[model samples]
Target: MTVVNKLTRLLNITYPIIQGGMGNISDPNLAAAISNAGGLGTIGVGDLPINEAVYKVTEMLKQTSNPCCVNIPIAVHPNVSHIVQQMINLKVPVVSLSAGNPAPFISLLQQHKIIVICVIATVRQAKKAEKAGADIIVCEGYEAAGINAKNESTTMTLIPQVVQQVNIPVVAAGGIADGKGLAAALALGASGVQMGTRFIATKEAPYHKIYKQAIIQATDESTVIVGRRYNRIRRLIRSEYASKLLEIENKNDDPAIFFKQTTENYHKIGAFDGDIKNGFINGGQIAGLIEDCPSVYDLLETMTADAKQILKQSLEKLE
Candidate 1:
């Protein structure tokens, strides 16, 4: 039997997989590549302005005929309305919202009849998102990379709780790299799976080579959380900068100083300059599971094939 749902049918993808949108990582190239590979690809326009976002959407659409998604994290940035209207005007297939309740933007996108998916870290947040007219709810665990909510929850516990509370389809994320994780998420009542760290190890991702290498050589404890005072806690790879940040926090030092120092150099040291030592590596615990960097197509093929095999075997054992 085929495991299909509104996501698969609406996105017209063979696998019920959605590429987790990572800021500065999920660009037009990577997004199109994943969609072309038979999964829902997502471009993170959470930080971009409306004009740039429109250009990006047009560029990405030119790359693939398949459906793709655009992510907007409304809590951090200004011009949320402009971005939402731009996405609607472009007719983007899907919009995945993170870091805030999507209720306010629901009506804006609904007018265009756009499909909306909201990312949540807790069951309460999931219920809120579903009530806000989210077509799909992605339950992200504490193990995820990048910016996460202060009230972080593990996917193993959060997924079942969210599935029980919401009638909409749930997609599980955080520390998912291979088929075993995918199968486990499905067994927990998620209709699909979303992964960011796994895709960062792909060749199409625009992140620096050093960042990808760091992901490959990382361990379960390689990640640390920082930036709590700003109401945004980010899980980043443990580097010299991250270590310093922790030291300051441990001593109960001023968060403003840490935020200033990090904001001043985090992007330059990590993204633009690719300074792996002083730079902050935004990644998840799943980085430890990845060894080699492959094309997005190859990665999806392996994941889907292995997941099918494992799931089929489990059913056979029951028989």
Candidate 2:
């Protein structure tokens, strides 16, 4: 049998697995698919308005009676109050927060009885989230795709440290794509794992064909860190734009010009065309490990099976 924890029990899910709330990519269809496969699916509504956020939640619920979560990046979207209220009104069972504090909104949501999970990049932020009333803290590492903190910490060094500091359940993120990672995180005192890049590579994700192919073909050395000068570091697959960004950064180019050039192509290539070479391929180093694009069920099953095998092998050694 697969291991179960208090978090899994609380969320009424069979596995302590969750799909990370990735903006633009993690929508109702993708979120519902993850939940249907027995993991918590999170809808990222940071880019959407309050009305659209509510509609997205409603549509996700309609997809599966199984519970799902909605992630709100407080700093990027100022409609968190409305989003939280919408969650309460719509009765969303779980809500995850990133990029900002959830304190002011926590009480409001807790009053309606919502499970709150906060994404933290540092031990200090983890402690702050706990004090601010986060039910669970997700320690996202520097290896993760998307916007990572400037003072990025690797998951290997950060997970156990965050676990040691926070009394609440800690979910490990960044570069985790398979059962080996799941087992390692559990061993490090993490209750579960939250994965984004791995899921994006799956068939369920709404990424463009080019984007998915890029992930499939990528290796550890295929990605580069960009936008560090602006204090908003993101990991993207090494491409034309990525190379140019690095070149500009190395030249010590103007910050404003650098940001404009980098972001200008993000939507044109990634969002619209899915051109891997010129588009935004936000992904973790795990891109190197993912060789095939499997269905969500296949991936989850393999992870659970592998984790159980690892546990069994460890016990055999004890005997």
Best by lDDT: 2
In candidate 1, what are the lDDT values of residues 94-212, reduced to their tens digit?
89888776899986787787889899888788888888888899999988988887877888999999999999989999989988888899889998899988887788887788888
TM-score of each: 0.93, 0.93
Task: Evaluate model 1: give its lDDT.
Answer: 0.82
Q: In candidate 2, list every pair of residues with a backbone clash.
A: none
Candidate 2 vs. true structure, TM-score: 0.93
List lDDT for all candidates, in order.
0.82, 0.83
Worst 10 residues of 2 by lDDT: 263-272
The TM-score obtained by model 1 is: 0.93
- Candidate 2 per-residue lDDT, tens place, 173-278, comes to 9989999999888888999999988887787777788778888888889777888877868888877767877887778757877767655346346744776456
Alpha carbon lDDT at 159, candidate 1: 94
